[model samples]
Target: MSAPPVHDPPAAGVVRLPHTGLQVPDARLRVVRCRPHYVNRWEYRALLVRGEQRIGHIRGPLPDVAEPGPAGVAGGGPVVSFHPRGRAFTEAELEDFAAACRLDGQGLSSARVLTLLVDEYRIEQMVRGCARRGGVMARCCGEGWVHYIPLRAYPRSAGQCAAALAHLERASGVGGPWRIWDGQQWSPLSVGSGPDTSPGCA
Candidate 1:
């Protein structure tokens, strides 16, 4: 006889559900529910991930039927668009998902939600500061958008960001960005700062 299957624990700030479907055997699929950076009240996305790679995603208001799936989700919802590679979700799978994340309209805890809101506000403020000051490293949020991150907040190739410390150092005209201070004035950086290196002139 085979032993019962074991599942991995969910990551921090991420809620996950075990998938019991034949789509991908060995219980590899994980149904994750979390608040995205741009989510409305009670709105969240259900991401389907196989192992470490994300396979697909569906968005909608939780505790209610999600947006009609492209392949006609398990619910009576009709199909609007179709993708050749998309897989249809079975009724059982949908039911399990609903049961896992059952919640009322108010949504997650007020304290937790408030903390996330404050964090987002601070990030936006920093991005705006980058635009007003010089040293913006990149422009995001579609074309023509002024949203950016200053070189001081740029992440290293290893995905490390010492943004707060960098900000203080740069303000003192010591270190940070693609430039340095040589007692009298700031000068171009002497070496590449890994992935955060500034773009060269054309």
Candidate 2:
């Protein structure tokens, strides 16, 4: 028999992937409680806040919704609990979370951000609905410049990658564009004025 369609009901134990839709607006957070599991890692209960109002709770090992261990606790990983809107955490936001919890430097960098992993092969599976095939499709600044480029065309280093994206934006005359299917909705890419000598995020 032919395999089931992509949208067909998933078999037992199958997982649906998530996307990074947006950043939490005016976000403020505080860790109310924490339970340590592994070194530099903890399961936490936090409050998501906006201005002076408490908005929601962020309870996590991030994997609890996907694979909970005994008693509904999740196995070890970075501490993360996204908002209901499928938004991802930013580095600055994660730092804020870590600060409120008084986490050491090691723990500070362990906060997880939700994002889609894109590779040459995975790009094929991800961009299924696009008329194009093989390479990934991208659109920036709402300009009519929609096209597909292979993953190899993109540089791996942050400095190089940012430069390439900046060049692409200038060439296409699009300001601050969000590419399709990448799960990254951030604005147009640009590097700082000086040489980016520092090593990218560790």
Candidate 3:
């Protein structure tokens, strides 16, 4: 019924298996397996420990409070877009938007970021640039201790990111009846969206 501890509880943020016994239905947005060969290899069950450290059984499921969270307007935080339209965002405003995702102190509870463009051409360009030049808006997502953007969301160069895999809690909009890719499919982010009235304030 319950899985025994393999090693001392992972250090904060290190991915670990869901508790065997007191499993909460929705406590964790996701549970993943980490490969010992990979860098983020903490996604598996605790490994077997040796010596006098046998007391390292997992205490119990993390309390509900341990859920990762996002700040500023639910999980939306602030969204950055490549759409060169109605409003232009200063560097500061863009960074602030990224900051909202980490307020909850959880690992990136939501890593699905919405990127919009003026048209298919620009969107394609962004995609191409990410491929040729390496990295994409996902990199711009932020590096705040893996909070602004979950390590999982980070696209390895070009169009390799599976943002949809992670839970998208909150989001903001900009550019065109811009499309929204909320871990599901591409749809309109807003029904009756309009351009921004102020500068750099998406």
Candidate 4:
């Protein structure tokens, strides 16, 4: 049987997202809740909202979507909860992953922990995906630029991967999309800054 519609006095016109064609009706969410998905333990299921009027909660990270963890939750890893958008790994989560992999992450620098995390992902592909190495869930990619991705979630496409570069833990640039940082901290790297660091420096 269909679940009884949880609405009183009903709702008005549903809001249709033009790009994705997903229609969401008017639902006031005073509080939102989240938990891991049951069937696809890989995904998370948010309780949608609290106190009555509500829209259905979201599933996993959508393409170009924002991080889905509850608001106010500090984002750092080795204990990251993976979303489509990359999430910072928490130290605890990092340790757990290390233990499962029979490796160690104790007292390591954040960058070093991230490197170790990437190494295990390389050494064990499917095992890492299926098992719980850390609380922060992640998927694997081959190598290169992805080596130091701060957010461990796998980028599904070029756009997704490019979007993540800005948030990378060891990224070597500045600003993003439009703003450029000419390779020097506090310096400028903009559209016509060109092959000369001399102008940005001085």
- What lDDT would each prediction earn against the true structure? 0.33, 0.34, 0.24, 0.30
Worst 10 residues of 2 by lDDT: 101-110
What TM value does model 4 have?
A: 0.20
Better of 2 and 3 by TM-score: 2
Tell me the TM-score of each prediction against the true structure.
0.21, 0.22, 0.15, 0.20
Reference-based TM-score, model 3: 0.15
Question: Which of the two, 1 or 2, has more lDDT?
Answer: 2
TM-score, ranked from best to worst: 2, 1, 4, 3
User: Any idea what lDDT model 1 has?
Assistant: 0.33
Task: Give the better candidate number (3 or 4) by lDDT.
Answer: 4
TM-score-wise, the better of 3 and 4 is 4
Poorest lDDT segment (10 consecutive residues) of candidate 1 = 16-25
Please say which candidate is ahead in TM-score: 1 or 2: 2
lDDT of 2: 0.34
List the candidate 1 regions with Cα displacement exceeding 4 Å.
1-24, 36-42, 64-202
Candidate 3 per-residue lDDT over residues 1-202, each given as its tens digit: 1112222322344322111111111222221111122223221121111232221111111122222443212233322122111233333433332223221122121112111101122333444444464332221112232111122223333233323222222232211222332222232223343322211101
Q: Write the per-residue lDDT of candidate 2 for residues 36-81, one digit (tens) a residue.
A: 3443444444444444544444445423333543322236543344
Single out the weakest 10-residue window by summed lDDT for candidate 3: 16-25
Give the winner by lDDT: 2
